[model samples]
Target: MKATQKGRSPRGILAFVVAMLLLSGSLRLGSIGIAVASSTTDVDPKLGNVEAVSECVTDAETHELMELLKARSEQISALEAEQEKRQIELANAEATILENLSRVEEAETRLSQTIQRVDGASSKDVNKLTSVYESMKPKDAALLFEQMSPDFAAGFLAQMSPSAAAGILSGLTSEKAYTVSVVLAGRNANAPKQ
Candidate 1:
């Protein structure tokens, strides 16, 4: 009878169940033996809280991630600074362009005024010289014209009456007359069209 009782002992059954509960971690053993048990088929809300054990990140890996984040942040800062510098340079260039344009306009105005004054003085001098030549005898005027350079003589002839200019040219040497004639003809060749 003792041998048969040992085979069916409640203590032995409790010990076996306790060992399974500890290994599986889905059950608990109480003083009464197998107080709570969970099977694969059963749905328990507490099962969602269970977590599998996993290895934590090493110190080296943590340090590498921190360095990568720092590098990225520094790169972003540098890009922002470069962008700001470019914007300032562009603004300065625009200001300089505007200033140069204003200066060019002022220079153009001054040049135009100076040209007008020179033209007025030149016209007055030509009129005075023409009057003086007209008052002199044709022979005397011809003598003076022959001594002038061909280009200079051509300028005076162009301002005179056709009859007066012809008298003066007739007095000159044939070669001098032809040279003066050519200069007068080609004088306005480079004049711009309106």
Candidate 2:
């Protein structure tokens, strides 16, 4: 009996836990009484007829609920992290698309400017060449024409004034003149039929 008195029993520990729970406002005196009455007859004086069964049930349920909440929290955090990663990737993809669009727009602008410059230069060169051919002596122009392919000669002659073209053609060999005339006539052969 002396040894039992010296050591703390399960009942004493249970009474202390109940007291703490009561102070913490987790367990009511009425609930404690119900728990103590069902579990043991020899209730501790300090515990005042409290039951351990209800308190144990409440504690077990609270612990299990906390574990479930922790698991759900972890899952929510993982989902949020995945969502954030995808958002970042989407942003990067959008940025890349915008950059490519900008480059394409720049390429188109440059191409248009280049085309305009080439067209302007070609027109200037054709005008200068036509003037040079028109000012040249007919015999000299015909000599140049003879060296050129019949199609090439016809292209220059077609651009000249009719009288100037006739003068140059009169100096050409009859075969060459006929060939040039044929080429000039067929030049518009592909015109759309009415």
Query: In order, what lDDT does every prediction score?
Result: 0.82, 0.87
Listed per model in order, the count of residue pairs whose N, CA or C atoms clash below 3 Å is: 0, 5
Q: What TM-score does structure 2 among the candidates reach?
A: 0.56
Residue 116 displacement in candidate 1 (angstroms): 1.9
- lDDT for each residue of candidate 2 in 1-194, tens digit (9 for 90 to 100): 56368897778888999999878775577688878576654556896874444333457788999899999999999999999999999999999999999999999999999999999998788878977998999999999998899988888888899988998999999999999999999999999879
Which residue runs of candidate 2 sit more than 4 Å off their true CA positions?
A: 1-84
Candidate 2 clashes between residue pairs 3 or more apart in a chain or in different chains: 32-50, 32-51, 35-51, 36-50, 36-51
Which candidate should be chosen as best, given TM-score against the real structure? Answer: 1
* Per-residue lDDT of candidate 1, residues 3-106 (tens digit): 45768677777888898878666433353253223221244467756443344446998889988999999999999999999999999999999999999999
Measured by lDDT, the strongest candidate is: 2
